[model samples]
Target chain A: MMVYVIKVGGNVIDNPVLLEQFLADFAKVQGKKILIHGGGKIATRIGDKLGITANYVDGRRITDAATIDVVTMVYGGLVNKQIVAKLQAVGCNAIGLTGADANSIPASKRPVKEIDYGFVGDVVAEELNISSVKLLLDAGLTPVFSPLTHDGKGQILNTNADTIASSLAIALSGSYAVRLIYCFEKKGVLRNAADDDSVINLINRDIYQTLLAEGVLTDGILPKLQNAFNAIESGVKEVLIGHADDVRKNTTDAVAGTLIC
Target chain B: MMVYVIKVGGNVIDNPVLLEQFLADFAKVQGKKILIHGGGKIATRIGDKLGITANYVDGRRITDAATIDVVTMVYGGLVNKQIVAKLQAVGCNAIGLTGADANSIPASKRPVKEIDYGFVGDVVAEELNISSVKLLLDAGLTPVFSPLTHDGKGQILNTNADTIASSLAIALSGSYAVRLIYCFEKKGVLRNAADDDSVINLINRDIYQTLLAEGVLTDGILPKLQNAFNAIESGVKEVLIGHADDVRKNTTDAVAGTLIC
Candidate 1:
């Protein structure tokens, strides 16, 4: 069975029209199962509205109590459903998931003792329940994920979608043909943020880090690249970082964005 | 000083046109506020298309690993942003949130060790941060939330929107005038679900059980009524269960729905 894992970025998620378009394209991927992982952009937006200032320390969202309430409502509630609706509208079988389901992605609190960060979590793949994934894929449903998860304890923590995608890819290591698709605007990861045409085609961990060091990969690309590395190391076959529009282009000759091997 | 906690339902959220209409009415509500809840129907639609059978035990979704992934994308990614964009389009400064940010809602995994119900979570309210709510309200912006939360560990879980709403109402009890406007197809909590005219004017905890016992209320009303009761008892001044059409009406006199005292 062919299983493709797509990691959608916060920026793409912020744009519903673009996301809708991506869902349409996702429906066209024939003979393969699809899985999606999304970030908390919507949660962030609601947090901003509710006077909840989200402080990201060390690339992790520092969630407090009030913020957690809003995040739950937006990420798992509104945004998760909307994507499912879009997929279904165009006739794609989509299933939505969070870290809590099946204990799929075993997570724990970030362990920041001083900040009192309420529900922030990190993914632990080894302890995840991968059987649930096999069951869904066996039945032929596309899995879409939110970045919420829990430690074995009752505490559910906020997780990064990319990290979830990576951990999930590893947890289901030999089960599915996992491909991480980081969809954003600007045609892919450009050498510079301003140029859309300068998409980087392929990179290993070394080149990815080098670009990061050289400041060629900036903004959102940095976290995504790191996730790409993590995913590849975790067992995902190919990590495709490209424009949401270029998802279908078959290319051994390089398409758009950076591809991590 | 006036903060309205509007509980927009999954049904309304499933239909984009209805969602837009809801947003239009929602924009009319003036206050430093937060929108708390999730969209399940939309997720269900996606699940159905994907051939994933969704099982809900006691109104809570039973998620498998793959289902969790699908839900996260749909809720955290699509539905949340669509609402935010709609709000923004209408000039309503709205932001979306998931539980991870600011530890909005401290979540823990459902501790039923024997039952392998994947990804469901419960809230631990004390861990949430309310400072964001204060800031957003101060800035005259509204927060739209999705029901995805974390348990402080590294896992993200799916949570009930009502639970999140109640928790937030209690958390923000000291400050805002928290009123839950549960928008649904029903006119109000009918003395009988079949009779729209027989709306229950006021329901105290004692009388609520009586209504259920008499077969005057059945089906979904039980949980909603109980949730409303919990909210009021927890300090929310009002709980209005009505159709979206009646949202802008004179809520002071219990316009058209069940008024849980």
Candidate 2:
């Protein structure tokens, strides 16, 4: 059976109504669709309420010991559980986990220097347990994951969710049809951020790099393009970048967003 | 020479004035002190403004391909650079990184699962480039790291700051004096969340397991205690769980929080 991978951004989650709409629509998909979500906003909100001030140097939130505690408590503990409940409420059999459960994602904490940021981890994809995910899928349970993971030493560290999806896309690409659906504010990938008419269609590995180099594509657009190329090269059949409204459109159509192969 | 690792919490970072005060205080530290910070709240806020959402499962942020892009732009691109600027403004020569520049944190994406969560990743601490940290410290530059890291696959993944701190502590433990200072809202690790006087001092490995079994701890505290133990086992000398108020206190005092050794 063809399997689709969908990444739900944290912005969608923040707006419960928008998330609900997406969930409702997601449930109607004819085939199996894997869902990944973001919750940094929610976690940070709770952190703020608890008088915790989240810190970022570049763009990464430094997960110190205390922040990891809050993230595990909020993101893993509360947000993940709640997302599962919501999916379940809509009749989606969703299971919740940290990257450590069933070795879904094996990891180790990054070595700290110049600063002691605790509990921030990096993924060890080689050690990932694909069987665990298969088991959940076999059981018809939708796995709702939090970015929280663990180092081999048994410490749970806060990690990124996007990398999780990319890894999954590569892991399942050989066996199943993987579709990376990114729900963003823009209708799709536009040639120019301001001019929607210039949405590019079908980008290969070489062209993607050129755009990135010329600075024609910069900022947030960079990693997405890289991830799309990574997924495509790894065997994921197609990559779809679009807004929430275009999800149901024929993925191959230019209306949906940028298509990368 | 003795080196101590000090982790600054997000709470202090949220309040610019308080953070400035901290920077001033840190400037006065006599010996070599490595600082790590958490910046999730602000990152999330900025992501929201940019129409991005931050998601997590367990404790990991769901970094789908697109989300990873947004995160890198936000965390590594803007936030990390901004922090370096902030520290520099305070006369602290700081260098920012996304863990990829120096291969400081080697990582891999979790295996693709039934569902795709995009670019989420975890750490490979053993493969970390600690020499990069040493180089910066040798030149008197305080390295400020954003939580975004690469999986050694030319992909960047958002990570929790805390795990970064812990891993760094463990890796550097053999060479430098490591002290993990986690400041939070609570004054210290309490025997009972309601009782401030229930502060416990000096928890070893075995007793921590006892506390978990006895249900004396729950939620995020469980993971933190586990991380504390892991750090100690991994060779980190001293771990302190306390409040930001005590940041300036005598580093050796068992003054207000739980001490893990």
Candidate 3:
């Protein structure tokens, strides 16, 4: 049996129509699956409304104390619960969770080097609780995780959703043939930045290195591709990055988006 | 063989020392247990900080859209996760949840009678998902619930923690001998509002109604006592209302707090 670890970003989550469409398609997936979500834009927007300005270093938000509170509310409370309820409405037995819930994932605070990223967490793959997650999956419950982890010292830390998805996929790969999916707004990793239809259908580690050396892949796509390749090397059976609406189509045809092997 | 349903209010949750002490004691409780928590004051404080003025009618905060967002962040995100983490540190495996998780509790939006309570939810006992909860409990996992429920229609509704504790106790009574405990700052139900030591040791239904008629049991204690008697009549084995610090003492002595029969 195949298990999928799907990660969706704010572009799909913030839009009600896109979210509903993605969840409906997600519910149709066969076998065991998990959904990990990101809500950075929503968190920042809510922070702005609350008069808390967001600070970013190298395109990653520096999570301050107040910003941590805001993200917990937006990502863990609002976005997470709303997605679970929507899935429930579509006959999916979704169980929403943060890392602190059942101590499913314990992360260490990121050590400061160049910038002080307050309250940000880095999860080690070994510390992930596979048994508890397997228990939920065995009971036919789909776990929906928010991008939050605990330090096991009563502190909730903001985490990266893609990192979480990849980590879960790598850790669970020992028991299940895991497939990691990254769903967003674009068709996939575009060969040309301007063309929505210019998706690279397949990429190996050599192609990824060549794309990086040629400066064809830069900015946000770099980290995503890095994560995909890392998951593949770490034993994930496959990795796919594509538009949220094309999940079913991509999986069915086995030819959509960028497939990393 | 026995299940304990403990409810703690904001008075304890808002205080760091008191909360740690209480969770330490709660972690020591033998056998299966669950916790329900309230966050009215914390929610109102966050709402005020966000420039959203809270509206109230007959002492219940009208859960308008903004208030609902605030409470969801404070209660479900901040407070719930914090408690679960604390419990984990004490070697107790706690899984935090809102009613929407696993569709554990489905409620209906409260209909406007004389007051429009905005997004408040009223849960019917029949709609409670006892099996999912039992799955967690039987696995030796403690469920820490925040006072939030969904309407099964994609709307998250603000609920009262006391009501949730009572409903859960009533629903689970058939499977285990359930003991419902309400923990707060005070020693117990006091004869006079000012005296902390003047706790009524026991109160039957007749005495409860007589005390209410005589205007002795008024204000916050009234609703709590009502919930206590409701639980008892609904088949819960025991109900206790008292100080959070005295939970272990109360259970051991079987003589602490006001016992409702």
Per-model B-chain TM-score: 0.91, 0.87, 0.96
For each candidate, report its DockQ versus the true two-chain complex: 0.04, 0.02, 0.71
Angstrom error at residue A210, model 3: 3.2
User: TM-score per candidate, in order?
Assistant: 0.52, 0.49, 0.96
Give a tens-digit lDDT track for model 1, residues B162-258. Answer: 7787777777777877777777878787876667787777788788778767888877777777788888887888887888767766244536666
Off by over 4 Å in 2: A113-117, A250-255, B1-261
Candidate 3 CAPRI assessment class: medium
Candidate 1 Cα lDDT to native: 0.68
Higher-lDDT candidate of 1 and 3? 3
* Cα lDDT for residue A114, candidate 3: 90
Residue by residue across A1-261, what tens digits does model 1's lDDT show? 546676666677788677777777777876455455465466675567446788876665678875665565567655665565456556665556556544566677777676656677867666777765565566555667777775655344677777777777766657766666766666777876777787787888778768867978777677777777877887887787787787765222345667789
RMSD score of candidate 2 (Å)? 17.3
TM-score of chain A of each: 0.87, 0.90, 0.96
For each candidate, report what fraction of the true interface contacts it reproduces: 0.05, 0.00, 0.72
For the predicted complex of model 2, DockQ is: 0.02
Per-residue lDDT of A175 in model 1: 72
DockQ of 3: 0.71
What are the Cα lDDT values of the candidates?
0.68, 0.66, 0.88
List, residue by residue over A168-220, the lDDT tens digit for candidate 2: 77787766877877666666667788886577766777877777776677477
